[model samples]
Target: MNITINTTVLPHLDPDESVAFYRDSLGFEVRSDVGSGTMRWIVVGPAAQPETSVLLAPPAADPGVTDEERRVIREMMAKGTYGWLLLAADDLDDTFQAVSAAGAEVVQEPTEQPYGARDCAFRDPAGNMIRIQERR
Candidate 1:
C-alpha cells in the first residue's frame, strides 16, 4: 500500500479574512473554494506546491459539533491557541518582511533555531500560528 498527504484542515472563524491572509499576504493560490455560509472550505497552497493545500474550514462546519463546542473553538482561535501551520520558505528575512508589511500579527521575528534553520512566526487573522522556516 502507498499513501501520501493531500489536504490539511485548519480552523477558521471567518473564511474571507483567513483567505486574504493566505492568498494576499503569503502569496498562496486558492486551489478551491467550496461550500457556502459557515460551512465554507477554502483550500489554498503555495503556487509551486499545487498538490498540497490547506483547507481553511469554519469550526461550525462540522455537523457533529454542538453550539457549545463551536463557541469553545472560537474562543481558542481568538486566543491564538487553536491551530498552526508551519511553512518552509526560501528566504526567511524576505518572507518575514513581506508578511509584516501585509499586516500579519508578528509573533516572532526571524531567529535562528537552536535545532538549525532560521524561522519566523505570525498569527493569522483568526489567530492561528503560522510559522515560516528558512529552507536549508
Candidate 2:
C-alpha cells in the first residue's frame, strides 16, 4: 500500500494573518481560499510538493466542541501551545535569514541540536510554533 499525507489542519484565529504567514513568509503557494473574515479556510503548500498541503481553518468551527472547549482552545493558542508545524529546508541558515527578515516571531535561532539535527523555530501570527529543520 502506498500512503501519503494529503492535508494537515491548523487552527487559525485570524485567517488573513495565517494566509500571509504561510504564503508570504514561508513562500507556500496558496492553492485555494474560501469563506471570509475569521470563517475562512485556506489551502497552502510548497510549490514543489503539490501533493501535500496545509489547511488553515477557524479554531472553533467544529460543531462538536463546547463553548468551554473553545475557550480552552483560545487560551492554548494564545499561549502558543495549541498548533504547530514541522518543516524542513535544504539550507537552514538561508531559510532562517529569509523568514526572520520577513518579520516572523523568532522562537530560536538555528542551532545544532544534541540529537544531531540543526533546526530553528518561529511562531505564526496566531502563535502556532513553526519549526524548520535542516534537511538531511
Candidate 3:
C-alpha cells in the first residue's frame, strides 16, 4: 500500500491576494481557480510537483461550522495562529531572500534551530504561518 498527501486546505479571506502570494511570493503555480470574490476556491502547488497541491478556500463555508466557531476562526486567522504550512527548499537563503523581497511578512530570518534544522518563516496574505526548512 502507498499513501501520499495530495492536497491540503487553508482558509483565505481574499482569493486574489492568496493566489498572488502563493504564485508570486512562494513561486507556486495556480493549478485551478473557481468561484469569485470571497467564495473562491483555488488550487496551487509547486510547478515541479504537479501531484501535490494546496486548496485555498473561504472560511466558515461549511454548514457544520457554527457562527461562534466562525468568529473564533476568523480571530485566530487574523492573529496568524489558525493555519500553517511546512515547506522545504534546497537553498534556504536564496529562497528566503526571494520570498522576503516579494514582500512576505517575515516571522523569522533563516536560522539554525536547536532541533538541528535550518529554517525560516513568513505569514501569507491571510496570515497563515509558512515555515520553509532546508531540504536535507
Candidate 4:
C-alpha cells in the first residue's frame, strides 16, 4: 500500500483569522470549506498547487476527549509548548515579512536549519506555532 500523511488536529483556530493568514500572508488558497458541526472539514493549500491541502481541524472535543484532557491541552498551549505547522513557501524571507506585516506574533526570525530548510516561526492567535519553510 502506498501511504502518505495528510491530516492532523489543528488548534488555536479562528477560521477567518487562519484563512487570512494562509491566503493573504502566505499565498495559499481555500481549496475546500465544507459543512459544519461534526461534518466540518476545511482544506487550504498554496495557490500554485491546490491539491496539496492542509486540513484545518479544530481542538478536540470528540467523544473520548474530556475536561481533564481539554484542560491539559489548553495549558500546554498557553505555555507555548505546542508543535508547529510547517508550511511550504517559495521564499522564506518574503513569507516571514508578509506574516509579520499581518500582525502575527513572530516567535523567531528566519534562519537556516541543519535540515537545509530556511524558515521562520510565529504563534497563531490560538497559541499554535506556525513555521514557513523553504525546502532545500
Measured by TM-score, the strongest candidate is 3
What does candidate 4's lDDT look like per residue over 3-119, in tens digits?
765554566356777667667766678887776654445687766663466776666647699989878887777666754587767777877788899888889899888878788
* Candidate numbers sorted by lDDT from highest down: 3, 2, 1, 4
Q: Clashes in model 4: which pairs?
A: 12-126
Model with the higher lDDT, candidate 1 or 4: 1
Q: Which runs in model 3 stand beyond 4 Å of their true positions?
A: none
Better of 1 and 4 by TM-score: 1
Which whole-number lDDT from 0 to 100 does residue 72 have in model 4?
Answer: 84
On a 0 to 1 TM-score scale, where does candidate 2 land against the true structure? 0.96
lDDT for 68 in candidate 1 is 94
lDDT of 2 by residue, 1-136 (tens): 9999999988988888888999999999999999987899999999999999999999989799999999999999987899989999999999999999999999999999999999999999888899999999
User: Where does candidate 3 clash, by residue pair?
Assistant: none
Q: For residue 44, what is the lDDT in candidate 2?
A: 95
| Per-model TM-score on C-alpha atoms | 0.91, 0.96, 0.97, 0.77
lDDT of 1 at 54: 94
Instruction: Report clash pairs, candidate 1.
Output: none
Preferred candidate (TM-score higher): 1 or 3 = 3
Best-matching candidate per lDDT: 3
